[model samples]
Target: MAEEVEARTLSRVAWRFIPFLILCYFVAYLDRVNVGFAKLTMDTDLGLSDTAFGFGAGVFFLAYFLFEVPSNIIMDKVGARRWIARIMLSWGIVSGSMAFIPEIASAIGLSAEHTFYLLRVLLGFAEAGFFPGIIFFLTLWFPASHRARIVGYFMAAIPLSSAIGSPVSAALLGLDGAWGFRGWRWLFIVEAFPSIVLGFVTFFYLTDRPADATWLDPQARAWLQRRLALEDRRREHVSPSSALASLADHRVLALSLVYFGAVACNYGISFWLPTIIKGFGLSIAMTGWVNAVPYVVGFFGMIWWGLRSDREGERTMHLAIALALAAIGVGGSAFLADPTTKMIALTIGAFGVFASLPIFWTLPTAFLAGSAVAPGIAAINSIGNLSGYFGPFVIGWIKDATGGFLWGLVTIAACAVVALAITLALGHDPHLERAPEAAE
Candidate 1:
């Protein structure tokens, strides 16, 4: 009866939250990266060089990195629903404003470069807390053992957004002349609308904690609350860290490097892959479909990888292996002459990079508990996301200098290798995952 009740509770929680959160993240991510699709025409239309566009695209992360930890800490104090609603609404407005950078530049007598950079920085600030806040919120509701798979389900939205959004964004590009708007402008304006709508829905729908989930029966709610509390006490008993200590912890620092390497490649690919596809001489719509193929593969890869880690009760080897795969795939892409082969190589890279993400979270939250959870997740994410700024900017510079993306792909691959080495050395403690009953 107890086992049955627990299963029912888990099922209810997953059903209640997972799909909605996926939708929320899907909207957020699509808005973030649709800029990739926009770059196809927007670059030429705005007279942007590769380096200039890269600077604008990458600048989002500079602002994001600066504000991330503080935003997350505020989320912890004010609660996830309010914080996330604020994030979605504000970013939606800023993202929509990206469509008007040229007109705004003309009116203010500012350079388009400065206008692009400014809006991106604002978008970054608005979206700062959404990702890690979701991660930390999951920690509040789910037990450690279930986190890898749960995170896998949620983070799969990353690829799904890219895959599905690719074609949709392309179609919006067809709206080029409607209302005297360019297709890329239409893309930004149309994509930005959903987030504002979803933000309002999120505020009303999200239950802040298990105790507040009145939709659940008393038995299921009580079981869930007890399970989460016990997990918290167990983790705090082992590694009890305050928020400040977590930021300074050596393990967290090391993990941040791994995350940094992973994101560098992730964002580098996201911001530039479409341009590389366009180089194949396909139309805008065809490029969107072609670019989506790898992310489709990656969607399954993340699910399989996360579940395997949970079943094995392992962390280190899984994270290390994932990084190695990404390093090899991305590094090898530079050497391939055939575009088809290059796409396949990038697909392999996508699998490893995306697969590594949810499983990576399992490591940090495994030991770090108490007040540390918020700032710790925030610190690690903030440091890692620094790559979001550097990766694209550097890649753009290299593309202009070398006349291609080969060496740039090679550079990002090296970052992946650095990550793999750290994960191999850090090692995982099975004790951190041991349930309190087992320890007792």
Candidate 2:
């Protein structure tokens, strides 16, 4: 009877929430990374060298780093529904405004490069809390035992964005001269539209907590509330007392380092993969389709690895293995000159890179609960995302200096190796995940 209730309640929650959240994140990630696609031509238009483009691209995260913790704490105070909606609306406006860099630069008497940097900064500030906020919000709805798989499903939007968004973005590039706007500009306008529309819909559609989830039948609601409460009670015994203290917790700092390595690998590839593929002598559209291949592999890897970790009730080893694979694949890609072999290596790296993400998140949520969750997750996300700046900047600088991507790939691989070491050393406690009823 308990098993049946668990199944029914979780299923309803998953169905009710995951799909729509995925859609929201899909558009969010597309808007964030679509600049990679735009860089194909925007570089030429703006007279940006590779290093300048990378620095401009990475500036987004600097703003994201500055604002993420406060934004998340604010979301916790105001409720995810209101704060998240506001975040979406603001970012959507900023993201679409990316289409007008030249005109905005002219009006403000700034160069286009500075305009690019300014817009990226705004986009980062607007989107600051969205990811960690979602992670914290999930802990409110689901138990730790179920989180790896649940987070896997939620974060699948990352790879899915690249998989599907790649082709669509590439195709949009075909509109180069349509209506007197560049195709990249059209891409920004069209993609930003969904986020704005969805921002309004999120308020009406999302319930803040199980206690407030009136969409469920009474029995399911009671079961969910009780189950979640039990988990929260168990967590109270382990978590830090306040959000501020969580920022200084040893585990939090360690996890931040682990996440930094992973983010380096993720953004390093995401920002540059299109450029790498284009160098293969393919046209813009073909480059988009090819870029989708690794991400498609990564999408499945993320889901499967998350499920496997949950079933095995292991976190550290699972994360370590995935990071090891990422290090090997990304490092190997550096030495290969053939596009086919190089792509094979990158695809394997993509699987490892993405698979590690959901599993890595389980470590923090395993122990953090109540007030600690919001700031802890936010701090880790903010610090970790600093790599979003360094990774792309280093890669672009390397490409400029060496006239190739070899050393850039090697640098990301080294970052992954560092992450793997950290994960193995942390050593998670599976006991923290048990429900109060189960423990008793």
Candidate 3:
């Protein structure tokens, strides 16, 4: 009877939340990285070099890192539903405004380059806390045993955005001359509209917590609340209660380093993958399709790896192995000259790059609870995302100097190796997953 109730309650909650959240993140991620696709043509229009584009693309993370912790704190205080809706609405407006960079720059008497940097900074500011906020929000509903897979399902949006959005964004590029705007301009305006619309939908659609889930039967609601509360109690018993203090914890810092490595590889490749594929002499449309290859592989890898981690009740080895694979694949891609062989290697690297993420998140949430959850997650995310700045900037800088992407790929691969070592050293305690028997 207990097992049946648990299954039914979790299933209901998953159905209610996961699909909608995936749609939200799918659009969110697309807006964030579609700039990559834009770079193919936007560079010539804006007079941006590889270095300029990289710096502009990367500066978003600087703003993201600065505001992330505070944003998460505010979400904790206000409520995820309203705050997240606000984030989406604001970012949508800013993201759409990206279409008008030249006009805005002309109006302000600034170069288009400066205007690009400024808007990306604002977009980052508006989108801050969104990802960590969602992570913290999930813990309020799901148990530790369920988190890796749930996070996997949610984060699958990252690759899904690139996979589907790649071809779509490429296709939209064909609309270059429409309404006197360039194709990349159309890309920004059309893609950003969904976020603005979904922001409104999210407000009415989301329930802040399970206790307020009137859509659920009373029995299922009660079961979910009891289960979640019991798990919170178990976590609170050993974890730090103060958010500020938890930021100083060793585990948090170590995990941030591990994430830094993973994110470095992620953003570095994300910002440059289109350029890499375009060098193969493919048309813009073909570049979009081919660039999606790795992400398609990553999409499946993320889901399968997260499920395997949860099923086996393991964290450290899973994370370590993924990082190791990422290092090898990325490093190998740097040397392979053939487009086919290079893409095959990059696809393998993408598998490791994405597979490490959902499992990595499970580590911190396993221990951090109560007041610590928001800031702790935010700090790790903010600190780790600093690599987002360095990753692209470094890749761009190296490309300008070496006239190729060879060393850039190697640099990110080294970061992954460092992360693999740290994962082994920091490790994880599965005992934290246990809940008090009374709730069951």
Candidate 4:
């Protein structure tokens, strides 16, 4: 009876928090990737060359890298509720502001090139802290054992947002001139408003910790608190100041390398996939709808991997195998000349790349606990994001130079192979073998 009751209670709490996390990420991702959709129109309208578009796209990660660690540390000090709300509201306003950049440039008589560059830089700074902040926030609610599945579910927001945004952007692009705005401008305006509203909702609904939550019954609250205490007690103690030292450890460094490779492939595909598909002579509207299919496949793939990882109680093997599959899938997409074959390959690649995300997060949360967990997670993510800059820039350069995406996909495949080797080498780390109790 007690076990059943506990399960039911936890399920209710999970339902509440998980969806909010997913929604927060959904908006974050929409802001992140809407630029991809916008590129379909904005590049031409703003007279941005291929290099300029790629640079602007990649710039978001530069700001993301600079602010990631500091933001996580701030979230740690101020609590998730306020920090996240602030990030959302501020970024939402900036996201909406992107709609007016072309006008601002025209009004100021700046060259078209300079205006787009300025807007992209500002957008990057606004969105800097979101992903790492969410990762740090998850530690407060879930134990190491439960975190992979939760992270998997949370990470699913990326694909889900893409799934929804692709068609919505397609629809918005079709609405060109409805309100005296270009389709891309409407895309920016329409997508951004939801984030501001969701930010207010987050402020109202989210609590920093279970102990701070008054909505739960006393029994439920006490039960959650006790379980979290036991989990926290099981881990070794390290002060927040020493957190960066973990980066010097071989195990953490190896994991960061793997993360770097995975993100390279992940973001490379995300930023370029629509353009790759459109190269096959599809219309912009069709390209938008078709772009959604791979992410739809990815959504299911993430759930399958997440549940399987939770059941198996392991991460390295799952990540390694998935990354290897991604290497083949993406490589095949690039190498194959047939449009149909390329679509199939792209869908397979999407599934493999996204499926590995939850497992990637699990490795860190499992190994690093308490105060060390936030900074350590942020550091890994911050370093891994270096690929975001490299991925898009390299892909754009390859496409421009070779007149094909084949070399770009091949490069990402090689990165995946390296990630696989790193994952295999990871078993020797004492961190992976430690009991969950010890992680606390």
Task: RMSD for all candidates, in order, please.
Answer: 1.2, 1.0, 1.1, 2.5
- lDDT of prediction 3: 0.93
Cα deviation of 60, candidate 4, in Å = 0.5
Off by over 4 Å in 2: none
- The segments of candidate 3 whose C-alpha lies over 4 angstroms from its true place after superposition are 438-440
Scanning candidate 3 in windows of ten residues, the lowest lDDT window is 431-440
Query: What is the C-alpha local distance difference test score of each model?
Result: 0.90, 0.92, 0.93, 0.80
For model 4, residues 53-106, the per-residue Cα lDDT tens digits are 777788778878888778888888988888888888878888887788877888
Error of 3 at 68 (Å): 0.5
Error of 3 at 249 (Å): 1.0
Clashes of 4: 2
Clashes of 2: 0
Total backbone clashes of model 1?
Answer: 0
Which one is best on lDDT? 3
What TM-score fits each model? 0.98, 0.98, 0.98, 0.93
Clashing residue pairs in candidate 2 are none
